[model samples]
Target chain A: MGGGGEVIDNKQVILKELVKGAPKESDMAVKTSSISLKVEEGSKGLVVKNLYLSVEPYVKLRMKKFEHPDFSSFTPGSAMDGFGVGKVVDSGHPEFQKGDLIWGIVGWEEYSVIKNPGSFFKIHHADVPLSYYRGILGMPGMTAWVGLHKVAAPKEGEYVYISGASGAVGQLTKLGFDDAFNYKEEKDLDAALKRCFPEGIDIYFENVGGKMLDAVLLNMRLNGRIAACGMSAEHNLEEPEGVQNLRIIIHKRIRMQGFVVFDYFPQYSEFLDDVLPKIREGKIVYLEHITEGLENAPAALAGSENVWKQVVSVSRE
Target chain B: MGGGGEVIDNKQVILKELVKGAPKESDMAVKTSSISLKVEEGSKGLVVKNLYLSVEPYVKLRMKKFEHPDFSSFTPGSAMDGFGVGKVVDSGHPEFQKGDLIWGIVGWEEYSVIKNPGSFFKIHHADVPLSYYRGILGMPGMTAWVGLHKVAAPKEGEYVYISGASGAVGQLTKLGFDDAFNYKEEKDLDAALKRCFPEGIDIYFENVGGKMLDAVLLNMRLNGRIAACGMSAEHNLEEPEGVQNLRIIIHKRIRMQGFVVFDYFPQYSEFLDDVLPKIREGKIVYLEHITEGLENAPAALAGSENVWKQVVSVSRE
Candidate 1:
């Protein structure tokens, strides 16, 4: 613990209560506290000065608290946690150094002291944008890559449909699929499969479910594979509409699977091996929408409906 | 068409104006036709005396031209098409002859001239109940087998969740999945995934979406897979509710896909190789809630609210 260092109180955004439909400003409250940024002497912990925080649609989940046998829901009045890019201002662990720039699980505040650094990765490519840690270079990037390559396994000339296509992960993944697999993007989701995939949709990286999924279903080829990615379109609706054309699943003998990033975390290095060099070589195009300051963090994460890569730079860069 | 055959008008159940939500008896009308059963010499079609017709929940889709694209929705006032077992009364096609047992796509009537004799597969497994083809060995049965094995691709010990678990296709598919993959039976549904899948669900054959899908999303393993098979749960709901855990898709990387059977026709023979032996042996179990009579065909195809697979046998034998 740095006893003599000037300790600024940590400010955080917390859910005021379970949100209803689209969130309003009242759904959250920003709380501040003068807490020491130090792990216990013997604890395997790292104190980080958060340089960047990712603004993602997934945060809406923290607004609800539901009991699950396998998992716990987000409780009200709790600090929001997500992937953060930070510098090791102080470290009590051997794996991290004081000056190292690392990205991992952290809070939406100026600084955070994390104990269970389960999947945190040290930012090896500091020469590139650190914000990339949250995007093409990071979670959203890996989300698109893993889903398209690993789960969906798109082959060249296969019809690939992405729902939340304009969103951060959606856009990057579309390019990823386009880049990795020789795919010609077809706009008429249904007709695209008919035109591009005369044989039919071989692989689908599903990001949007509703109308997009409906259109894609009609053209899915036999033995088609779909990676169930996300449903950003149906996220805020009161009652999610039942998807039509699911009967094709049985008829076409399709394969649809969902994946969590952590499930592929063990392959993170492998992900880096395949991705990082391409990113550095400028063979990849990355998009990042950065929102500066903590006061703007809540609204930025709330009000802004960005269709692509978005991030909240919580601290003074 | 036969010119001298007894041209007595036979009755057929016809859907009138489009019905909303679950179909009712009033949604359909019975009309008589004087069309002869004899096939035209040049038509290359088989005159099938329908011994059994397969009425499945998917027929409900034909009740109206849903905005979400699927197979051509049933034409109003037309004899709706479905899979059925029949005896060939006569044939212009060289492959079919009188007294041959055949089943495939046919009209919902006693005598139907199946234009495409190729669609009908000659039933060799007639030793088992012919009605089994109306389900387990037929389209619904193929649906269950292929849907579970092909679409779901359930890994052993993966938490496999089926929504319309009690229906004929749902039950049959559930049985197949249970036999093919290791899954815990969960009927309470509201809390089934939670109680049965404390470690979280790995694969979800989504026959029922809406709230059940929402809850299932909450308990999914990080890289869980979902075969977006059917959403019978919210089929009737005008406006579906927003799923809370949808955003978990990005974090967990879940895949949700919709499909159809038309594309897999090539693999029909191969699918039989995997499933028929299972049926021939007492290894697989199937059940159908039979709604007797062609007069009740509309009501049967309408299917009950949240009820499992119900079959209406229009043929005597």
Candidate 2:
């Protein structure tokens, strides 16, 4: 192990170029570089040794060249940043100290110097798998919880429909969903939704947007609630598909709302308190496709897979 | 006048055929039918002389032949029913008496036997124009108030954008809006919205959907609220235009909700209590294009005129 401020080799995954329509593995390359394992003095920075990196579709959105205040595009010739589990190697902040386990935004590299440690959440409970922080107990899980409990606010026995039911957030929401089917397998999405929900959907956890959203709009019951978490289907396209059934919103008195997981960061501790016990008691089921090593991250993210989560293990503690 | 159950000629606006794309004057015809100007014995019904009939865009939606539980399409070759101000000539209902001014769903004929008098709201305050019962004090007005105050729940000084800003409900909402522009005048809707709302819109009263909705989606601020009151622009078209910018809902964390006025019927008296005073004090602005006689009713509803409310005066007194 390197001494306090000694420079060491840092293996990083670099975004080679801005992605256009769809992200390709060729757009990212693994590069080795030397970095001083030191937090800048007087700066509230933490030198984190990234252990598990979450591969999310939103990262691909950041890979695109765009100018918007909401999302800052990832810079070319730099390591792509995303949600990850990390150990603090060095800390310049009072709250965090060396060897503290945390989860937040981190670079796709062996080591990342988080300048603003305020965004990071300290790992309070470790009874569950540490990798769970990157999936079920982290951003995606928090998203599902917030979208369901806070946004959609479904009543008991209400018909709940979920698109992208194979993803991280979708899988964790098994308790609420009555019927599940692969949207890809259906030749007619509207017909499939009708078949699944004969009475029409009361609560729709919207993850896959575009055509799915269009079909769901037609099937939504009166005063139905749609919590739009993500639009994974349209994110990769240069020109997103137009939704044709928006008029149904008025006809059915639907409440379609969109939300981001980061907005519910204040309730993370509350979420952890509620979900941790459920997970430990075998009440909650979480699945992940964990790929070992940083080299596989590009393939894992770029390749289409029917997995709950695509997590890349950089360095297992 | 006939003493009791004498048969009277009822001049009616009958939907000649189910309208396909756009409603033409030819689709509706003025017909006369003889009806008893008396309620049946031991029935909770009121024989009403229809005074003012409101020409609404939703009535056009009902012109189409389709089966949906939410809305009942107007039966072809029958007297079309909509919001109207009427006076009770004969009453079998205990709550209602002769000469009581009322506003409710009434047939587009001179005299209507309202079977469901429970749906009707008695007009207690008549200091303001009785035609206001067909507009500013009626369904569309209730819709606007509910959408803005109840659904969107905008804060003071929040950027409020209203499309179809010259309609019945739209004209009545002059109190809240700061910027007003005709959507038809703008060459590019997105640019127009951007020019008007440089800071981006916070509350959007969505009356015109389709392309206007697409443009508004791009110009919405973070955590914006969209109150879907009506979609007048897309109602006439056989194929409604697809909204392409719905992803902005997720990016901006927007809440777009749809509501029908009937859903808030419980709040009708409350709405009237609030708005009636404002109208009496000349605080609320209401404009209407009143076309006299049942023969001109079809033309008024069909013609594209820049007016707040299109009301047919069936019987002034």
Candidate 3:
């Protein structure tokens, strides 16, 4: 081993067991263990101190056992892993060196040793807040960009309705959508959508599925497009709600497409180039609710229903 | 009006009233009416002798009162109009002339005056059976063509499933698609789809929606595409059955699109050019159930459940 260093205490938020329905704080535990800080000679491994951990709605889906390749379940007694920002403590990887800031999949812990750092992207723009990697410049931001620009392909002046407008990705909907709504506040989603879009919705950025999807289907215009981003409403439910108004899609000639942000990882550089300048110029505003320390990650994730982006800060530097 | 020759007695199938649920033979009445076979000068009108009228499943939708621009309700006490083959007896339009074979919207009557023949397409290829205009060369054919070739756009060897395989458009599904099934024969749609597509369905031609759509949603593969062609099961029901498996669309990254054949009307000539030779070479086999006379049109339309393509012959020649 090249950079063999003294062992240090590492605390990780571990999943006690596979969760069903709504996840509770008792489902996870913060355990501390000693770890050697070193990188094997020829193995392109990276030792990173996790700076911030992102709490996303999809994490709830992963908490339950799923056969889907996209939403693989977390192993019991293992540290929960998701998109996070980290600083390289030690590296054997050619692309990454010590002290380099990177963002990708990382464990919810004080430090994570990545066997393969190929998937990680180097944080080039350091002038902006490093926490932006967890919210605005990271997975959630790319989701809104890809779903709106690529999947929906909305036109100028078209009426766009975004469901779950208070989530991390949903908040970023302010980038291009004509109208955004907090679906929780509406007594009748169909009525609210009708009032916002008098003619009808041309594009629907769907984050909250179930009853919201049914309502959007009823209010869609002719040849409307829908981007099926996520279903936060159905995430915690064992049995999701039924959608009734799909027949309207036939009458209106609507197109609904589903996509994952990871599918567009190759275009992350392009996304960064396009969005970084916008962020710097104050065109896009990012709101984050940061919870300090790795011990608090479990509660932050469980109670992040109203928060736009719940980012747990593991270290200040 | 040079061709104002004869005032002939025309037998017409008139709609008694707007129908709900399943239509009945009693909903229509065969009445005799007089009409002069003439086109007014400088009016760009034409006098057509109806040869054959197509009995499509969508005609049932028109029987009910709907506010949708596409599926307009049929007027009470008026001759029901639909796609048909006709011979231009008299013409003032530049495109159509006397005795020219044409196919377009025509009433369920022997002879009629068309004030706007601009929508009519002149049949240049008279070599094919004229009845083909009511089946393969008509609206149903175009529906299958546009939905498959243009909308779904399935690739080679992809697992394709077609519901309602006995309908007019579904019969034409033999042109493309890896597998086909009559939803009527299948008891458990989910098991049937699993038996047909073990891995998963890449593209689904959704003709019979309702529960069939729910089952197909579960069997859809990652990045699957669905062409929402029709929902015969829901069309009859006053309240449609809610689709429960729409959340699967988000997990599978499925794209479902709805389309109308009229949107592709401008491309009909292109469709004829593509499909004409395939029919001439006997590559495509068309099955038609011919009902003689306009008086039986109502019965043929009402009881066309088992029939592939029901063509009501107003006049053989």
Candidate 4:
């Protein structure tokens, strides 16, 4: 075996305990452990060196214990798993080989042995920044696409409103949406929405729930559609805020639907084909707030204020 | 012209003033006025002898002044207009002939000349009680059909929950839905829902809204659908109650849609074709709370409690 086959020191961001309310930096611990940098014989796993880890708002939902069977909570004293860009160091799987760059659900560590590498998408376009796989070219990007085009099915000249218009999902939504607003800056969300859309919102790309959703409901036009992508505003709350104006949904004949991105994976290639050219031509703008080391990831993920997009860089190409 | 064409005393229920909150009997006054039972010479209208007037919760929305353009309030001293079954006494419109039975928007009066008879639907099936045209075979019936089958799209063996399950709309829903419960009797709605549907609700026919909607949201299964038919509970309130569990919509991947029966009018004949046979086979049970005479209509409409379907019987056939 080559010298590169030697055991390496792996740094991982471990969940110290199940989080309560908003996550804190203390809820996570950075641990260093030794790992063999070689794939075991007869194994169908890919040993990947994680290059970039996406810090997503939905990951917060996985930190708490809940009876929801669809989502599994992050195990205490183990590396947290999320969407990340990685390079395969060793592989026993047919689809992936050594040095193949891929992106999918991966551990928040320097290196991880992904047993089921079927979820991972091999990166074909290396011309763009590899980190783009974590944000604009990853699951979040596809979520914005499917939610807007498939669920909402917005028509031309229709008023579209997007909450969390500065966050990761929101930023991606801005590419397709005609009008966008940062909900945090608005004093009266209903008034602001009314000003932006005098007639009323025809389509609302909902990322933040609670007061934002309540306000959106009041301003919806007749036959308005709401594509609920995420509820970041209600995720950390012990008791989520009450939405009062839901009755407006009846008056306006609105259709509100919630969807997860996992269902839209089959359209990933189609999305890439449509988006890659626009990104290359500078028609689409992508931003990332990168934290340099694994040790700083906890603070960056838990309490990064006013950031456009949060990502943790564990290793370089 | 026949002797019946002579000017006759029309008993009309006039709105004294715009109603606030829950309507009261005092808000309306029964007045007698002279009117010719004949349409104008060249105008397209019909002179109708009102048989049965339907009392609906949405008619309350018209009692208050709102900027909503789709509906207009009843004039302070004019007869209130609502859905009713009538016999055409005279007609200038080609669609109607003398003595033709019909159902549509009509005044809360014994005899009146309708300027716009365009909205009327001809009653072909006379074997069923004409009063059934106001409840089980009319707008409320269509509401239940469109809401359950078209919007909610319930599958066989799917758990269906209907709020306001004892009301007119709910009664019609029970004809299609296997499991139905009156939310008023259940002290703990969540517990009641859990007992009714241990696996969680797949379809919810929303009628009451407010607190009931909040409770239903918590028990919705993944990919659940809610057809918002009415919000009678919130219609009377000055300030509608806030719904706290809307975030569950995201977790459960729910679709909630609000619809009006007017949009489903084109499918009326189609709906009747499907529902008429069921009624003839004694498979569908119809209930009516008949309030005799135009004088007692106000108290009957505004104060009738525990009544399944409230109908103002204006004239005998």
Per-residue lDDT tens digits for candidate 2, residues A1-317, read: 33357889999999998988668999999999988798766778889999999887778778887655556888999999988999999998999999999999899999998989998999978777777898889888888888888899989889888777777667577665567788788999999999999998999888777899999988888889999875243454467788888878886899989988888899998888888888888888777778999989899888846344888999988
Give candidate 1 misplaced runs (Cα > 4 Å). Answer: A2-43, A46-94, A97-100, A106-118, A151-167, A170-258, A285-317, B2-38, B55-81, B156-161, B170-205, B215-225, B230-253, B269-317
lDDT of 1 by residue, A1-317 (tens): 34345577888877778866666666777898665766666777877889888776666544554332323445677777776789887777788888888887688777788775555788887778888887676776777778878887777766666656556456564444542211235556676556655665677766666656677778777778877654233443455445655555654667667665556767788888888787777776676778888778888777756343678887655
- Per-residue alpha-carbon lDDT of candidate 4 for residues B95-190, written as tens digits (9 for 90 to 100): 899999999889999986788888889999999999989778988788888898889998888888877667656667556555656676789988
TM-score of chain B of each: 0.83, 0.92, 0.93, 0.92
Ranking by DockQ: 3, 2, 4, 1
Tell me the docking grade of candidate 4.
Answer: medium
Least lDDT summed over 10 consecutive residues: which range in candidate 3 chain A? A230-239
**What ranking of all candidate models by lDDT puts the best one first?**
2, 3, 4, 1
Cα error, candidate 4, residue A135 (Å): 0.7
What is the C-alpha DockQ of each candidate? 0.22, 0.72, 0.74, 0.66
Q: How well docked is model 1, in DockQ terms?
A: 0.22
Better of 1 and 3 by DockQ: 3
What does candidate 4's lDDT look like per residue over A54-84, in tens digits? 8877577677875454567889999998889
Chain A of candidate 4 scores what in TM-score? Answer: 0.91
How well does candidate 1 score on lDDT at residue B148? 68
Model 3: residues with Cα > 4 Å off, grouped in runs: A1-4, A40-42, A65-67, A175-180, A231-233, A306-308, B1-4, B175-180, B230-234, B306-308
